[model samples]
Target: MSTRLDELVQELGQADRQERIELLIDLARELPPLPDRLAGSRDESHRVPECQSPVFLFVEPAESGRIRLYADAPAEAPTVRGFVALLVAGLDGATPAEVANLPDDILDRSGVREILGMQRISGLYGILRRLRALAAQLPQPESPAKMPADTPSADPPSAASSDPSTAAASTPDPEALIAALRTVTDPELHVNVIDLGLVYGIQTQGHEVHVEMTLTSPACPAGPQMIRDAVAALEKVEGVTKAHVKLVMNPPWSPDRMTDAARDELGIF
Candidate 1:
């Protein structure tokens, strides 16, 4: 059998853009999610106590090449959403100095928790990186003013072949769309669709958008309802003319999807 990497490399060379993207989704299925909790019990780590409750974490990429990070922490459990957001923020282009010098007060604030549906600061930074990388590899944009100084200091080959208007029209601000998605609540879970892991990836191409997520239960009868709700939520976002949802079952769901913070709040250890 061909390994995912081998298949991906082969697919990369294919002429069809759709086929290459299909390979990306297929390869994603093979990736092992990051571990949620450290080994050992609360007795092992006196500094951080574990919750007696349960929590779950789920992440999915959007059509716009952004990821939706979800955490389901019942009220009974502690909420580590803030910490996860901070980690994500630091992952961005902020200079090591900027990230390191950040005040603890800012990190301790619950604003991050309230904004779980938004892109982690670092996630949007990735878009800036990719834009630059592709630009470097490809031809320079017709308008230099459109490029930000911090934008990919070293431009790579440009994957952007269209004009500035086409490029801007195609890309959606990852953070903005994520914030919009947070408003969507799972009809059954009663929490934000984001918290219930009902909203996964969001993708945008020109005026079209696609979201990919999975229901907690494979046989969920609310699948259609969830899809409708998600589409409705995304359509409300400005600049989105079309939206779609794809429910993926590959690799299955488990507590492993929970973030480090979610694990701590739930004491999943």
Candidate 2:
């Protein structure tokens, strides 16, 4: 069985440009519609927004109507945004509460830098206003969002501790360890770091451990997040300690490094 990320990748490849785009637009429509009650919630301007990127993100209230957002990036722009929108749309049918249940691996499926970049997301609030208006006209409907147990989460106090040397020295639990790290993905690629071949090296001797990793882009926004998440992911290992993480920009990440599964997910064939 593939992870939700795997399902999303396959779906994106199968969708046409227009279909992929509208799918995101619909997700923008799914965020809980903000209300006059949210006066204390926002900065008081209370205006909505649109997604210029293919993916649209919004925080929604558990109850009531819908929140709509859209950002129509030029088809020529970088593609990952569209991919995000596409994936989120498929995930959107679930209630905001349910969607929130998603593990960081599936909901975020992105490297730390990517999640952090969202803090400075640009363009298209106008589209959000339009979607919100559109939702008001439709009959209200709801669904439950359930997070699968295997999903990856992005909570704090990462497995990587204040002391990398100590963390690396602990005994290891490979399955739990890999599960934790699989949650770390290349932000732009929205794919697991493991699949991206970003992990350059791993050396273990008894309890002591060492690790090396790289970014998909030299200036990736998810850098800090990836670093932080990597440490956390590795920290979960029982015998692992001193989980050292090193970042490399040389050689860079290439399509050649992509796993066969990753490639097939992108429909490269």
Candidate 3:
């Protein structure tokens, strides 16, 4: 199976122009605030000089026996912040070996080159180089023979496992599936597919699910990405084994289909 970073790369790589931008902004908002304990560590030694924005990063072993990354970037530089956030999310809690082995073309694989200018792209690579350097400072994990039998796993528990509504459901709940789908946003609208009324129907059979959905238009560039995202969301449900997404333009999609909240966000009133 692919690592979390690989999944993120595939998602960004498949996304349309508008969706990519929106996803990056969403990631920027998720960058954890630098903890007070590391406040003074923001010196030039920890900074990425190639980036126009002042960016600082630190890596350390976590209590869980995995790794943790802390970073700081100006709010004005959402693009930079977003890239940092992606690295942090994908690599945090990962084993040191995993971080060391990450591909150098990770940024290029994410399709970010199409979105950023050449200078910004160069700076992003610099950030990657700096992060790897910091991660290199950590002690490597010991051999299994030298470690305890109860060592913590590198992968974290899924969000679904923590939620009673999904975790305890004997069968896959349509509502749970819907909740998962809500995570998938329309690239152009920046509103979730659920709120946009793109999903026409959902059916569950045993551990499998089938969904019928539509796009804003047949020509919409972001349609494929939205479909892929929706499928990804559904499969994340606790009881779901597979998710099948079918595109249907027969009913089509319209502004009137948008929920009140989506309308408000778009100033559609």
Which candidate achieves the best lDDT against the true structure? 3
Structural similarity to truth (TM-score) of each candidate: 0.37, 0.33, 0.51
lDDT for each residue of candidate 2 in 1-269, tens digit (9 for 90 to 100): 12553566455445565664454445334433334554344431222333444333344433354333322233443333444454345444434323323333432332222432555433322322223322322333552212212223343334454456765555575555556667988777788977776764454434434555677778788888998888877866776544656675533454434645322222100
Q: How many residue pairs clash in each candidate?
A: 23, 32, 0
**Residue-level error in angstroms, candidate 2, position 237:** 1.4
Better of 2 and 3 by lDDT: 3
lDDT of candidate model 1 versus the reference: 0.41
Query: For residues 57-113, could you state the per-residue lDDT of candidate 1 as single tens digits?
Result: 333333333333333323321123223332333323322222222333331132321
Per-model root-mean-square deviation over C-alphas: 19.6, 16.1, 20.2
lDDT scores in order: 0.41, 0.46, 0.72
Poorest lDDT segment (10 consecutive residues) of candidate 2: 143-152
What ranges in model 1 sit over 4 Å off? 1-164, 167-171, 256-269
User: lDDT of candidate 3 vs native?
Assistant: 0.72
